[model samples]
Target: MKRVWIAVALLLAVLAGTLSHSFYLNSFTQELTGLLEAAEAKAEQNEWASAEELTQLAHHKWDEKTAYLHILLRHSETDEVYTSFREVAEFIQCQEGGEYSAANARLIAELELLAEAEQLNLKNIL
Candidate 1:
């Protein structure tokens, strides 16, 4: 009975950690997506400077979460996001609206997918 109780406690701990991580990842991705969207909007208006600033801010925020993300996420997934960020930054620097929008959209989609993948749902369990 004591061993069963110990096992139950450990299982509960793992569940709690998984749920917490899911919540954090969702929120973080949403925040980054919002920033990128705003930057994309600015670029649409030909506000290159503001767009660049917002992109940098979003990149900085992502970098700040690097260690935590690396721990809980596959490195390949995180690396894709990193590459997307670089592509967006380069496009913004060049003031190429079409390319910037495409890159920004890709980054946002990647973030959304990342969040979705981490969600604790029945589909994921199987």
Candidate 2:
């Protein structure tokens, strides 16, 4: 009888832990999704400042060690949205006889690296 009780307790504990983890992941994913949407909207409006801000918010809210992989994969499909805004911004600068700064180039490179890393990580997850 004692052994049966111990087994039951262990099972309950495991189940509870699993449930808690699932809930947390779901909540985090929802927040990440919202952030992604905000970024997309900002990009669509050619609001680079807002888009960058949204991306930063997403990064801060993400679980970098784990959630980042999933977010990266998701972001990959939306790259064109972001790239479009960036290109437009650059083109505007160019037309004004202003050079696209090295900083802007570096930022784009960083974004690409993040997307690639996310893609690779998604494969690993699968």
Candidate 3:
């Protein structure tokens, strides 16, 4: 009986960890997507200054979240996103609409892929 109880407790702890990780990943991706979208919108409007400001904000947020993410995510993917963030800022400064939009799209796709991988789904668990 004691052994069975210990097993159950361990199982519960694992489940809790998985769920918490999933929740954290989802929340982070949502916030980031919103930031990227705002930057893209500003670019669409030809508001280069506003777009640059929002892209900088996104970079700041990414830096703040990097420590936690580095533990949970693939280094290459995270690094790719970091690079994209920098490119987006540069494109915004140049007011290159096409390149700026493309960079934002790449960032959003990377964030989505990262979040999905972290989700507590059968595919990920298996």
Candidate 4:
């Protein structure tokens, strides 16, 4: 009876941990989606500085999402989207010799689309 109780306790602990991790991943993915949308909207309005800041924020959120994906799903479609957005964000950050407004705007739009698609995929999974 003591052995059976110990096994049951361990199973419950594992289940709880899995549920908590899923909740965290869902929250992080939603945040990334919002940041990407905001960045794109700011860029569309020609708010270059604000767009740049939001892009950085989105990139950070994507990084967190990617980390969670690595641990939970291990190279899912979201991981590919995260990698693409990370590359785009880095490219935008590196463009120092040109007028960044147009290029940044385009990148933001791309990031927004990618985030939306990823969010949809997450919705199906969840």
Pick the lDDT winner.
1
Model 3: CA > 4 A from native: none
Local accuracy of candidate 2 as per-residue lDDT tens digits, 60-103? 55435334444434555345435544553454334321232333
Model 1 stretches astray by more than 4 angstroms: none
| RMSD (Å) of each candidate, 1 decimal | 0.7, 9.8, 1.3, 6.1
TM-score of each model, paired residue for residue: 0.98, 0.52, 0.92, 0.61
Predicted structure with the largest TM-score when compared to the true one: 1
RMSD of 3: 1.3
Question: Arrange candidates by lDDT, highest first: which order?
Answer: 1, 3, 4, 2
lDDT of 4 by residue, 27-102 (tens): 6656765776676566667665776687688777666556555655636555556555655466456543243444
What digit string (tens of lDDT, one per residue) describes model 1 on residues 6-107?
999999999999999999999999999999999988999999999999999999999999999999899999999999999999998898889889889999
State each candidate's clash count.
Answer: 0, 0, 0, 0
Q: What is the lDDT of residue 13 in candidate 3?
A: 97
lDDT for each candidate structure: 0.95, 0.51, 0.87, 0.60
Residue pairs in clash, model 2:
none
Could you give candidate 3's per-residue lDDT for residues 18-65 as a string of tens digits?
A: 899889889878898898898899889998888888778878988998
At residue 60, candidate 2 shows an lDDT of 56
TM-score of 4: 0.61
Q: Name the lDDT value of residue 89 in candidate 4.
A: 62
